[model samples]
Target: MKDTAKHQGLRNQLVSLLEQKGITDKNVLEAIKKIPRHLFLNSSFEDYAYQDKAFPIGAGQTISQPYTVAFQSQLLEVKKEHKILEIGTGSGYQTAVLCAMGAKVYTVERQIELFKKTSVLFRKLGIRPKYFASGDGYKGLELHAPYDSILVTAGAPIIPKPLMAQLKIGGRLVIPLGEDVQIMTLLIRKNETQFEKHEFGEFRFVPLLEDKN
Candidate 1:
């Protein structure tokens, strides 16, 4: 649970690498810098936490690579106090980033072990998301509909209709869509029935599963 000066130095290097890879949003970068990513991984993986790579965090899921987190966060254009819904709260790394940027995050995770473990981690780190639930993300959190932005951290075979319907008008939903290798996609809700779509290359993630554990 220690975030040493050495860990901070490593994060600085990682942020520089992210900048070189075209992550231009300062807010995202700052959030990435502030969060102690090493604490989110198993102790054995702490040394590699700042390497811009994904690591398994039990339950057959992996914390997303740093670049993917930055890219998806940038696409959402998150603002202070934005009501954000995040699917797949794997290690709570993404949720912490959103919270650090001042978004009121409502995140859901299907893996029970991760959901419970990360819930504790959030409290220990003082990263207060609006809500965190153990559930099937494909359904979206309908109880809290109309989000300012939605971010899906895992690969999905299709854009889940429930998630699309939950977005506020002009809100963005950033997701990685595909089976094997996912395409990073952004969908902006134009109105009740229309969305503007864009794609930004490929990323691989653990598949977004259907039911709760």
Candidate 2:
């Protein structure tokens, strides 16, 4: 994918907008500035990539809005080499952002088509997550348990218990919880059984799909 100076300029503008909108995490903003968001979408929609909007990526999924990505990333308080489990790989844009910040990300995608497509894109962009699995988001990857942070990119009706259980004590889980319009919820693991909950404003996202088979 060709990332021209114009595209970089657009990303700079987007980062400024994110900052004005209260995304103060410098690393998060830097990742936003560095990643070529346009390369994550189909070439035909390249013009719309840098805007703070979601666009269809196929298999009934949309890449998350830039602000949403930044908000979730900032909430996670990602540290370099932190282990992160991401639900809903989608367009792989979120995965790339986590990777950019030096987190070892293990991402799950329920839609095989999107999973495969995004895997190819990650390779092309030279963005490598720690692991990629085509599986259920609700069933967080237990093989690599106790992540420092977990992020769910889709709208969930409830906090997936498996995801909550997988977090290390003091770990953060960022999810959009609802069926129609999601309330951005942050759950920080307080102990083996208790979690501290906080809510941000409302956001719209594609439903988190469960495997039928």
| Candidate with best TM-score | 2
Give candidate 2 regions above 4 Å deviation: none
The RMSD (Cα, Å) of candidate 2 is 0.7
Query: What's the lDDT for residue 161 in model 1?
Result: 98
Positional deviation of residue 103's Cα in model 2 after best superposition, in angstroms: 0.4
Candidate 1 lDDT: 0.94
- List clashing residue pairs in candidate 2: none
Report the lDDT tens digits of candidate 2 across residue range 179-213.
99999999999999899999999999999988778
Whole-model lDDT per candidate: 0.94, 0.94
Give the distance in Å from residue 49's predicted Cα in candidate 1 to where it truly belongs: 1.0
The total number of steric clashes, by the backbone 3 Å criterion, in model 1 comes to 0
Clashes of each: 0, 0
RMSD of each: 1.0, 0.7
**Cα lDDT of model 1 by residue, 117-175, tens digit:** 99999989988999899999999999999999999999999999999999999999999
